[model samples]
Target: MNRRLLVAGLIGIAFAAAAYALMAPAPESTSRPNVAVAVELSPAERGSLVTRRRFAGNLEPAAEFQVAPKVGGQILEVLVDIGDSVARGDIVTRLDDAEFQQSVAQARAELAVAEARLQEAVSAANLATRRLDRIERLEARGVASASELDDASGEAQAQQATVAVTRAQRDQAEAALNSAEVRLGYTRVRADWPGEDETRLVGERMVDAGDTVAANTPLLSIVDIDQLRAVIEVPQSLYGGLAVGDPAQILPPGRPDSEALKARISRISPRFDPESRRTRVELIVDNQDRRLAAGMFVQVGLESRRVEDALIVPRAALVNRQGRQGVFTVAPDADSARFVAVEVALESDDRAALRGVESLDGPVVVLGQDQLTDGAAITRAGQAQRS
Candidate 1:
């Protein structure tokens, strides 16, 4: 009976071992279809690679000069109105010149009188000299007394002094005439800037005709709209890569396919806004057609800095894992893929410049990265060449 029982226990142990072998999980299927993914990549080229930094900014006229009155007077007429084009030295407004004209006439009359007086004094002096000469001749001949000769010389000297006084008065009248004429001229207001007749943009009129204005009081504002300046505020940290004369691209939103307007950095604010920690950069662009107006928002791009000619990929192609940015690149056979870590230099709309890895020579997986492992096999391939 003991032998039979021992044999039964042995049989049960063998059965348990058979059941464990059948229930064990099967090895992972190596035949399952590898993850299928689409990819995009960038080919290395010698073309310009710009480190485009975008900032929000407003478009403004390159220059605006206020048109103001040079003297206090009532405005007689305004030759130009808002949106009127003007050239250099073009009169914009006029003041009432009635008083100034009368002053000029009065000065001219005074000057004429002074000239007449000067001519009279000249004639009297000539006569006095001639008389004194005759008297000296007579004195030399002993026909004139010493006292008489002295009196003749004194009369000539007095006439000469009168001529000098008249000439001084004439000079003073001439100066007054010049001042009166200048004041009359001040009644006509002219454009402050010299620009082509077609390029002027005139703003609101501060004073209308018949209204009086003080000297230096703004009559109107004239802006040259032939060119526009885009003022962008850039973070101080990124200021190092930007400088005057650097090329930039301006993208006016909602126009994607339109050619980017070219611009250059014209001014860089040395000081940063304390509240925003950003520096203002001014970009000048020609708008000869006046197509760009002030206050229009523009996207400013500063170009060409670091990591040129790097292998680039669409930003969507990347995946982050454990603080490392990586993407799955397909093997040559198009049947397998391997994860690769890449160093990013710059990012644009939907693409980024990448570095690291000897050869990112083939297509990279843009989608389906989350399901991928280090050595995952891929069945689908990217027909589009890598950007």
Candidate 2:
């Protein structure tokens, strides 16, 4: 009887629990809270975007050429050496002049002999003319024969022809003397050039004393360092923006603290190199202070045209999504970020020039854009988040 009563009581308690769960009401439905993305923001700005470009090149002498002798001979003395400063008309080298001296003396002697011969011919012509005159007078007075007069006239004419021949010889000898003297002058090779610059430095020495050289062979390399040529090649795209007389600045490679050397465009090649697609441009740099040197690598900086009233932003604020370039803009009081496509008209190292977005009056997401989507919740990095 006791076991039956306990089992009945347990069944009654289970029914009561089932009845209570069946009569309870459903709990109210709730939604999840949205989290804001922390991001660094920068204001969109309007200003002029300047386009600057830099090219690498080397410095070279503006004027350079090899100094060669005008006549061939054995070198006797090299007066100027590499790195030696020389003035206009300065003797750079000397050839063996013994042969030249002998030649000049021989020409002088030949001229003297020709002069004596010409004088003798003139004297004989005068004597013959006087004899001819006496013969003609005697013939007229019937004291001389016709044959004698004819013979006297013929002799005078012959003597005059001899004087003419000797005069020709004398002129030939005088010309030969001038030629010889000019050759003798050639023995002393001079460093000469046509310019206002009176001095230049020898850049190379090709021969030593006692070395035989032919005519027109290079003896030295003379260079003018008063000014230097800065040679840089630019791509076809940048070539159009460059022109003669444009201002430029040159900086030494690996030396940022050095002062920039002022320069201006001097020459621009009309055609681009097919192999490199680059045009050669030359700039003239004054080296009056002699602070720069040839063959040194340098960086040349130049500026192109500027875009006015364009929107600009930091490079970090711009991002590429899919195939479009754009930025994410957020209002000052807004809690979401929105993407806007922009045309990057110009870009420098740290800033970018934008186009066609006049409505960009708000700050752009700079730092946490990679984790953001269009219309995603965002908050300023330093601003407090609302609960």
Candidate 3:
């Protein structure tokens, strides 16, 4: 009876405990709130932004040509050396002219002999004409036979033919003399080309004094340095909008901080290179002060597009979310990022101009956007780091 009483009392106590546990109110605690993500932000701006494409190339002379001689001979003197400035019609090299001079003298002597023979023939022909007249008169008066008159006429005709032949020989001698003089003039090789440039630089000197060379042998390489060509290659995607007058900027080789030089597109190749598939572009850069030189590497910046008065932001701020291209913008008083769809107008390496992001009142997130969701809790990167 004592054990049953103890058991019944314990059961009653357990039932009372269960009843109290069920009746007690739940505690105020629940699930923890979402954690705030740390992100970098930048203020959206309203301005014009340009899409600039920079490429590496080299500075080449505007025009270059090999200077050569017209006749083969020994190089007597090389007047100009490499890096020498020369103008049109400047004599650059000389050849031995002793043989040429002797040839000219011989031609002149031959011409004189031919002239003397022509004069002798003319005198004889004149005498024959007078005799033929006398013979004809004698024949008419029956003082001479017709056969004798015919012989006199035949002799006069033969003398006239001799005069004609001698005159032809004189003309031939004059032509030979002219040819010899021209050849003699070739002994002095001159730098000549057609252009408006007043001067050119000697880029190379191939032959020196006492060097024998054949005709058309290269003596020097002349280059116009007053202007230079900035040659670059662009892929076909950007070649469509390019034109002849497009402006460009030339930066110094391996120097990104240096000032850029102004230039203009002078020529564009119509066809792309078959292997490279890139079109060639040539920009004319003024080197009036001779600041640039040929074969120097440089960077060329070409403006591919322009956006006027558009909303500008860092290119890093742009993101694609849920198949829509936009950026995450967080207001000053807000603790979360909001997705704002924007049309990208112009984009460069580090900046972008958007069409419809101006209405956003907060800065765009530049970093740590991949962890964000619509209305997700966020914290400034600076503030998060400080904490």
Candidate 4:
């Protein structure tokens, strides 16, 4: 009985220990660690936001004209060569006028002959008038027969008719003389342009000396480079916003360091091109220094819109949250940095203009905002402790 009691007491002690182990709680785990995100911050600024629209265009002369000859002949002399400057009424080219001069001389000689014949006709008409008067007087006095008076009258009328015919011939010769003189003047080709200075540059020379060209054949190309035109094709979406006298900036591709040329919208096409769905626009640029030339590719910037004193931030801070676009504004806490999401209104290439978040007065998260949530912890980039 003593041995059995000892064994039962040992078994009871083991069972009690197992029951206590089953009822006991496990030790609590440490709290989750705070999320660390590196961030760059920028201040919200009250500044201006200018919206610019850019387009590619080519420079062209505001006024371009082709010089052609009115009279066909062998080009005797090309007074102006390519790149030469000429003024209005300046002779640019000349044809061989020896033939034309001879024609003029022949016409003058014929005119002189016609004038002499006209004087002779006047004298014969005077004689016929005197004879007719004498015949009338004799017939009235009955000193001449009816047949004699009739013959005298017939002869006088014939002489008058001859005088009239000679007068018409003289008039015809005068017209021929004028026409010949005008033709002779056409041999001297002159440059004609409308301007106070009338000066222009010769862009091309088509014919050389001694080269034969027909009438109305192009001889040279003249352009006024003092003013230039930037021709740009704008898409239909942007065409309606353009108007005459709008300001523009023109930058030459070849000279990037040069200052942008100032221009104004001078023309806009009335119709759009169906194939391109674009409309042509012309900007008048003052090229008084003659730095810009035709056919040079250029970049044009048009001021589309502007907003002054707008709340702006860097574009890098923009983020999309729950289908809404906004920036993460830094909210300072006692020990950590909290990022609050703030929605924005307008955005440009480098900046965004804010609208809804009026309480945002601190720096915005420019970098590392993609891995953030509202009230998320962050540290300024380069300021975090090295582990």
Global fold similarity of model 3 (TM-score):
0.71
lDDT of 2 by residue, 116-137 (tens): 9999999999999999999999
- Candidate 1 worst ten-residue window by lDDT: 39-48
- Candidate 2, superposed: residue stretches over 4 Å from native: 1-50, 307-387
Candidate 2: minimum summed lDDT over ten consecutive residues — where? 378-387
Per-residue lDDT of candidate 1, residues 63-124 (tens digit): 78898877899988998888887777788898999999999999999999999999999999
- Judge candidate 4 at residue 238 and give its lDDT: 83
Question: Ten residues in a row with the worst lDDT in model 4?
Answer: 331-340
Best by TM-score: 1
Global lDDT scores for all candidate models: 0.80, 0.88, 0.89, 0.83
* Candidate 3, run of 10 with poorest lDDT: 378-387
TM-scores of the candidates are: 0.76, 0.68, 0.71, 0.72
CA displacement after TM-score superposition, residue 221 of candidate 1 (Å): 1.3
Identify the leading candidate in terms of lDDT.
Answer: 3
Displacement of the residue 86 alpha carbon in candidate 3, Å? 1.0
Q: Clashes in each model (backbone N, CA, C under 3 Å)? A: 6, 0, 0, 0
